[model samples]
Target: MITALSHPFFLHALLAGTAIALASGLVGYFLVLRAQTFTGDTLGHVAFTGAMAALAGGYDLRLGLFAATIGVALLLGALGRRGRPDDVVIGTLFSWILGLGTFFLTLYTTHRSSTQGNAGITVLFGSIYGLDATQTTTAVLIAAGITTAVLLLARPLLFASLDEAVAAARGVPATALGLGFLALAGACAAEVTQAVGSLLLLGLLAAPAGTAIRLTDRPYRALGLSAALAVLDLWAGLALSAQVPVLPPSFSIMAVTATCYAAAHLVGP
Candidate 1:
């Protein structure tokens, strides 16, 4: 297993995937507890359009996605809506970004001569074998940052997640917590989107967390289970992608993750 982490391509794939699994599981634990899954879904979809624009501009796609997601998150956090429907806000933002993406895609398609075949499909669905060492290192660093945040802010974050009213009453600063978490969520999605792509990103992030929740009511145990399951799913996906010809790696990972989720639902008590 460790040997696979040495081959140039496999090395990057393994590092990036495991790092993403850790980041997503850790951040997603809070996202799930706060019922911000919709926000995550929207931000990830926004990342797709951001990536497409980045490809067109000859910019680093991951950087572009991260910038866009961070911007969106700040905007949402700054709004700090009072008694408003959060879903509506997220949906509205998602529609605008996706529409912009569709327009850009049309331009890319019309320019055909300048477009690469790797544009939409490879980026949208992902190609795990394509990650390089630099990208893997970046993923590791970002995951480490997220993990540090979890360790440093766990008590307050969990307090805000479970009972914002009480936490705020106790001087927890729920608003600050929400804003901080928004930043964290954007950062998490940006890293994961680089490898899995926007389409399958949510599945990889949400499934493991969802499954972990099904397995245990205890938050810490659920987080550990989520990280473990997510790593297993990613490794299984990489192995399958290697063994199977003409099959995409994202499908393999997601399929295994889906199976895990279904099993959790069936066998969990």
Candidate 2:
């Protein structure tokens, strides 16, 4: 494993994974608190659609993923009058994006001459080992930006998330904070797509946060524990993947995260 660390791809994956874990931990705490797990899952589908669309249009897949997810995040925020987004609106968007993803998949498969039939699979499951230096840098920068934004909004966002009516009555911009947090969540989703892929992203985003919440009632401590667990998940997954080359890193990561969550649940609060 030490020898593998010398490899550029391994190094990139480590850095990128760490950044993603940190961002996911922070954003996910609020995602769980806001009960927006479904929203995060929907964003994964949107990310898949965007990446497919980019491939079909001969653009960078990352661009498509970021643009589509962030746009949807902002739209959801705007449609939401209060901190709580309208479930009906989210349902509508969810169906539309899934349909769009199907269309893009068909378009990509038909027009593309590339023999890589697994391209779509890669988008769905991720190809973290394939991340180049530029992609790693991009993921790290985006993660940093998302983390900083979450920190800046932490206090009010917490107030808004814990009690929307009370926070609004107390003059907190609950609506605005909700929107901003969703936007950050979107960005975090995009960043994580590089590490675990879209399909398995929810595990990475929610598991650590879920475990942390079960273990502690203190918000800051929960956030810290979430980040630490996420980092451990990624590192363990990577190490296991290295030891067993047949396993996909994304699957390994998700498996580790899921196992940890199960263990946490078993232990109880």
Candidate 3:
């Protein structure tokens, strides 16, 4: 264990995974609070399509990832009532995004797969263990930005999420807040996509938040607990995978997350 901790790759995964988990926890709290888990799910697919498009276009994957998710998020906000997307909007975008993902996947496989075969797989299942020092730093920075943004928005977002009607009546910028929150969720989705992959990103976002919500009635306490649990799950999963060579990090992290969530339900009222 100590020897594994000394390895540069493991260190990179630790740093990057911690950042991703923290941001996912913070942003995810409101996602569950707002009943916007479907939006997060949609953004996950959006991230995959975006990365594939970027790879096919020979550009940075981050560009496509951030752009596609954030853009669609804003669109959902704009089209939905009170900036909260309805089932129709989410379902519509979800289908379209999946189709676009297939198109980009085909393009990528035919034209760009020779140059970068595992890139697509990495976006699907993540490459946290493969992150270099620079990638780790970038992940940390992005996650920090997301954490800060979520913290700043927490108060108003909570108000809007819990009671948009009363919040708006009380002069809260519910529409704008909804737009901003969705964008942040989009960013969080994109960031987690790099750490846990687009396929499993929703689990990283939803599970910790859900567990915290189940465990506590207090919103603020639940928020903090969600972040703590997310970090713990990520760290434990990483450590478990480090110890067990055959276990994939993503699977390990989510396994811990699911277990925590199940325990919370069993314990909570």
TM-score to native of every candidate shown:
0.92, 0.95, 0.96
lDDT per residue for candidate 2 within 1-269, as digits (tens), equals 99879999999999999999988988998899889998899898889998889888999989999998898888887777655556677888888888988898888888885745577888899998999999899899989899899888989999998898999999998877888888888888888887889989999889999999998999989988998899999999999999999999998998899999999899975
Ranking by lDDT: 3, 2, 1
Who wins the TM-score comparison?
Answer: 3
lDDT of 1 by residue, 92-189 (tens): 87899989977766666666546555677766787777878777788899888987887688789888888889998999988887888888888888
**Candidate with the greatest lDDT versus the true structure:** 3
- Looking at model 2, the pairs that clash are none
Q: What 10-residue stretch in candidate 1 is worst by lDDT?
A: 109-118
- TM-score, candidate 1, is 0.92
In candidate 1, which residue pairs get closer than 3 Å at backbone N, Cα or C atoms, i.e. clash?
none
lDDT of each: 0.81, 0.89, 0.91
Candidate 1 residue 152 C-alpha distance from true site, Å: 1.8
RMSD of 1: 2.0
- The digit string of per-residue lDDT tens for model 3 on 1-269 reads 79998999999999999998999999999999998898899999999999999988989998999998999888888888655457886898789888988898889888865765677788989878888898889889999999999999899889888998999999999989988998998999999998889999999999999999998889999999999999999999998898888999999999999999998889889
lDDT comparing candidate 1 with the true structure = 0.81
